[model samples]
Every structure is written in C-alpha cells, then in structure tokens.
Target: MVKQNFILFMLIGELSKKSGVSRDTIRYYEKMGLLRVSANRRDNNYKEYADNAPDVLKMIAIGKNLGFKLIETKEFLEFWEQNDTDNERLTEMVLKKIEEIDTKIKALTVFKQNLENALIKCEP
Candidate 1:
C-alpha cells in the first residue's frame, strides 16, 4: 500500500524544475485555467501547488506538442478530471487532431518534394 504521508506539495519554483516548465508558463497556464493552485497561501504569501502539478504541466506540454491550443487543452483536461476515461467528446477531438496532422504531413511532403526537385535541377 502507498504511504498516506508521502504526498508532497511544492512551490511553483520546485514544480518548474521538476516539470521543465518555466514559472511564467506555469502562471500563464493558471491564468488560462489549465492548471490549479491551492487556495492556501504560504507564509510568504505564494500559492502552494499540489504534488500533481508537475503531472498536469506535463500533460499540458504533451497536449501542446500534439497541436492542441490552450482552450482545447483546458477542455480536454476538464473532461479528463471529471471522467478519468475516454469518451466520445475526447475521441472526436483526437480524431479531428489526427486529420489535421495528416493534412500537415501531406503538405510537408509536397513541399519537400518540390525542394528536392529544385535542388536536383540546380546541381552543377
């Protein structure tokens, strides 16, 4: 069994180091409602973050890497936090994202082919 007392709450600085996300980015996520901080303030008045903050930040990073906008990421995170399982909404979003990626890949391939053709013609 996991120890109940093992939970760790970190300040934003510690979370930034662990998650490889900047403090400014974390604050922006909080502003955008993508992340949450505890209501309880520290002695110095800085907000405390739950141990899961790093995981949430990592999720945001992955979502961004997958081409999700902040609003889309927030929607997905909200759904995930509520359901903890995939649903039609999430599936639809993912399918749409896949289509977008496919379109971009096709365009990039065409661009690459054009560049290669130009380079071949220019060879001396």
Candidate 2:
C-alpha cells in the first residue's frame, strides 16, 4: 500500500518534479477535469498542492498521449481501478479518437494544397 503522505497533499513544485510534468500543464489538467488539485493556502494566501497529484498528473499525461480527453481519461482510470475486464468502452474511445484524427488529416490536406497553390502563384 502506498503511504498516506504520497496521497494526502504535496506542494505544487514537488508534484511537478515527481510527475515529470510542468506546473502549467498540471494547472491545465485541473482546468480540463483531468485531475483534482486543491490548494493549501498559507497565512499569506500562497497556494500549495495536494499530494497524489504526481500520480494523477502521470495518469493524465499518459491518457492524453493515448488520445483520451480529460473526461474519457478520468472514466478510463476509474474503470481501470475497479478491475473491469470489458474493454469495449476503451476500444470505442480509441476508435472515436481515430475518427477525429482522420478528420484532421483531411483538413490538413486541404490546407496543404492551398499553401502549395499560394506558393506557386507567388513564385517569380
């Protein structure tokens, strides 16, 4: 079992170092609902971070890299923790992301064609 200190709370700086992600990225993930990061305010109102942040950030980064949005990532993690054996949902999510990628590829092809045309027109 992991120690309590590893999950209770940690300073943002430490979390970043431990998670191999930047503070800004962590903040973005929090905004996107990928992780829950609460602040521990000092007497002067400076903010700290909750522990377990590093692990959460790690999960978020991995999920995002695998094309999971924040919400999808959260659900995936939740289901993953519950020991669910069905992967139909996971497969669907991946397929959906692949569809999105296909759409992006089409859009990029159009843009590239436009750029090529513009370059040809401008050539002396």
- How high is each candidate's TM-score? 0.81, 0.61
Q: Write the per-residue lDDT of candidate 2 for residues 14-65, one digit (tens) a residue.
A: 7778877888887787677666645445566644666556666777778878
Candidate 1 lDDT over 28-72, as tens digits, reads 999999999877666789877888888788889889988999888
Model 2: how far residue 81 lies from native, Å: 2.2
CA lDDT of each candidate?
Answer: 0.85, 0.72
What does the lDDT come to for candidate 2? 0.72
User: After superposition, which runs of candidate 1 have C-alpha atoms over 4 Å from their true positions?
Assistant: 1-8
The TM-score of predicted model 1 comes to 0.81
| RMSD value for candidate 1 | 3.6
Taking every candidate in turn, the Cα RMSD to the unseen true structure, in Å, is: 3.6, 4.8
